[model samples]
Target chain A: MNYRIVTNNPSVKEVYKDIIFVNGTFLDVLINVRDLVHKGHELISHPLGSSIRTMYSPYRSIIVRNKTNEINKDHIEVIENSIYSYKNTMQRRKPDAVNSKDYAMLDLNLLKSALDEFKSIYDY
Target chain B: MKLELGRIYIKDIQFGNKTHVNNGTLIVNSQELIDKLKEDERVKDVKVDIARPGEKVRIIPVKDVIEPRVKIEGKGHGFAGVTSKTEQLGEGKVNVLYGAAVVTVGDIVGFQEGVIDMWGEGAKWTPFSKTCNLVVDITPIEGLQPHNHEAAVRIAGLKAAEYLGEAGRNVEPEEVLTYEIGTHTEEEAKYPDLPKVAYVEMLISQGLLHDGYIYGVNSQNILPTLLHPNEELDNAVISGNCVAACDKITTYQHQNNSVILDLYAQHGKTINFMGVILTPELTTLEGKFRTCDYTVKLCKMLGVDGVIISEEGYGNPDSDLLMICKRLEKENIKTVLITDECSGWDGMSQPLADTAKEAVAVVSTGNVSHVVTLPPADKVVGNAAAIATLAGGWEGSLEADGTIKCELNAVIGATSEIGYHNCTVNLY
Candidate 1:
């Protein structure tokens, strides 16, 4: 029933303690996290380059999220401009029911808020 | 193979000077029937009781229910492997005591035995309530182990059914229903345009209290194999299971399998009923994977377009159900699964322990954990206090006033996975 940190993010270690940490890049954590989950271990995926995928287990629950909001301040203007341009292009075309929203321009705060709520419910 | 089933409807049963069917009434010579069952050395004593459709009676700790059938023609008679000598069944002239069943009760084997109410609200949930039940209460010799006790009761029920079936040997049947499935090539040629469909029936074979028998052979020892659908109707398979009463497939269900009958009803005109595949539900992961792989392999070998899968027990078997469905869909074979859910008492828990995206079409039987209250019957057949330890019951399930408050798990065939009953689950 151990919930291990499967990332090298310094922020994760600061928040959690006494858990096995997988000191590796975010890509490494993504590739081997499923195996850990299969063994009844929960993984807290690094927020970098990840997507929201919640998998439930009786012993533990894995919370996966991307940390795009942690991007360097120098690239903020570029990322903002690219997101606005994509949103404007998507709005000009007819909206399909399944893809009505421009996911590329999603609000990053939503991810943080969701993570906090999941943590409060899952941290037992 | 073809089978001609002669139905002799029985309306009432009572003890008499001799055993015979007269004017829709079954007259049983109680002394003769008792003597026949006492022949088994393991049986210490035998007592017989009759429970009619509307009687205020309750039979508890029920082990198995069997329909009486006598084979008039063909290679073998009665239950192929257990009650009768070993032979390939399915093609024969058989007479069925259509409206009567032999209900066996005795010492408890596992916490999985059930209760059958003859009348009132509780009677509606169990199919055995509607039949004229010849309740057989068996007592084994001193120090008899659980294994032998189960076998003794199982064989006694079959023997009694076989003995009663002899009465219809010379009498004319009220109606005759014939079932036939031609050779593989002949059937394929007859229904060339219709889709070919197969049935996968999972049996509990966990040994000890949990097991099933095919032609008297322990099913846990075999791989997936093909069986003629008609053979099952003639007692090719028997139940040795002691799982939850609600979902376990009894010998009666195996003889009158609704899924096979439903599929056979649509054969030729709408679909080509290929055959049935019998697979065992093992305990270990490797055993499960091996059997499941063999099941899909057999289905592929048959080259069927669609298949219907039915599960016997719950929990661990749910994984096997999903695994088989996932493999079958990956091979492009359309599949529909029949299973009972384990939703909690509030009906808020997940229906199954496992799920697969490929299992899109499913027939959900009622939840096993749903609670029900039953008023006391005027007469209790077996040990009434045994309900306290039943799988779906707790320590205080039985009330002082004789009314019982327990989950559907304590009732036999309440959530039959073979679609034997009308109970189903719907989201509110």
Candidate 2:
């Protein structure tokens, strides 16, 4: 069970030692996810969450598994596109003020849903 | 499956002594209806109001919009399994109060709630503005979890629509719309020469404020499944999502799905309309792969020659949309997609979050980031200030002169990915 959680979610950071903690907005966290993909860590969850308004939230957490094989070009493309989308959305409407606890809670909930499915796949 | 809709056209609505439709006007017993919704223990209070087309009214921080309908010869009462439990749906008769809607407004989930204006420049952006909206504003009990808050309001909205729908149970409809599709094999044989067409409707099944329900079940937990479009059109499916207001398919949109209805219009004449493939836009990578693969597999199994796919929300589901399209095209199944864009307010950025060379036939349903200015309403139905926290609204979006400026993203149905909207793209 080797994985990493790239996140600005402080709750995930406090509990998970494998977290690559970020202190910026959702777009910044996505850029960090892109950097990991470039370093060959495959995505465990989609860089984008189930939310169409994910870019509106300042908090985010993405799951990934340790590199197993060669760099997956598709993962890189997905992350780059996600970053592009985030930038476009932010230009229109910026993320909620930092410490908007409700938005953070929502981001945590999204991570929890992804982690529930991730546990079943990564453990096997 | 064959379902007949008896539509009783409603042009005006007013609080009256009883609830009934009288010559195109819907009269509601305000106190009785408000009392009924308050019976739900999760709700602390209720406010009922009416906003008609061309009125100077603004409804804000809305949750869902549903058309009022009641079972005439249907197995289930109205919302099957939800409002009342009974046998399956899609083969029964239901009465629809045409041109009228029940709009739920609240701050349950906050950021994703939408706005609806009944007059002026804002009215041109959303379809709901054209309908005579019966607005219900509910407040949840203190300290309720976000999930409970969402459900309390969602179910309350459905119940409100069902309550009002009962008034049309026996009214004589202005017209009847019949949707009948035989089993896949039977249809294939009857229209042997016509192209076999199917519809793929992607639902945002993320939990909490983002979810769509099929027959009283959260779609996120289900796999890709086939359906008779009549089941959805008859109100078997519902929207419980608080996604971007511009693109979130309301329960009203589900009952009158433009894609499903338009396909029925071209049924035997142009194509052998198969049915709808219900797929979930889940939150995890594993679920995305599972559902997208399973969707195309079902289409391939049905021997589908052409397909129309519609997405519910944007961002992550953009990945799911392209994955399904890429797979269907690889199988030689002609594919067409309906989706909205997040290309910024200026429309300069890339439209979709993902892309496939195979998605050649695409339909862009307006830009969600397109900005609009709504004039102040003589009366506001819900909290107008709540927009500042909305996904598309920023601080100062509300002007001192009561002129509010916001993106189309804050306006409900302004960018319906289901093609249930007025915005269109013109090639120059």
Candidate 1, residues B96-196, lDDT tens digits: the string is 88898999897543233488889998888899999999989899998876668779999999988888888778778899988999988999998889999
Determine the C-alpha RMSD for candidate 1 after optimal superposition of all C-alphas: 15.6
Which stretch of 10 consecutive residues in model 1 chain A shows the poorest summed lDDT?
Answer: A50-59
Per-model TM-score on C-alpha atoms: 0.77, 0.96
Could you say which candidate leads in lDDT? 2
CA error at residue B66 for candidate 1, angstroms: 0.1
The best candidate by DockQ is: 2
What total of clashing residue pairs does each candidate reach?
3, 0
TM-score of chain A of each: 0.36, 0.89
- The local distance difference test score of model 1 is 0.72
Task: For model 2, name the residue pairs that clash.
Answer: none
lDDT of 2 by residue, A33-90 (tens): 8888998888888887655566677788888879766788988998998888777777
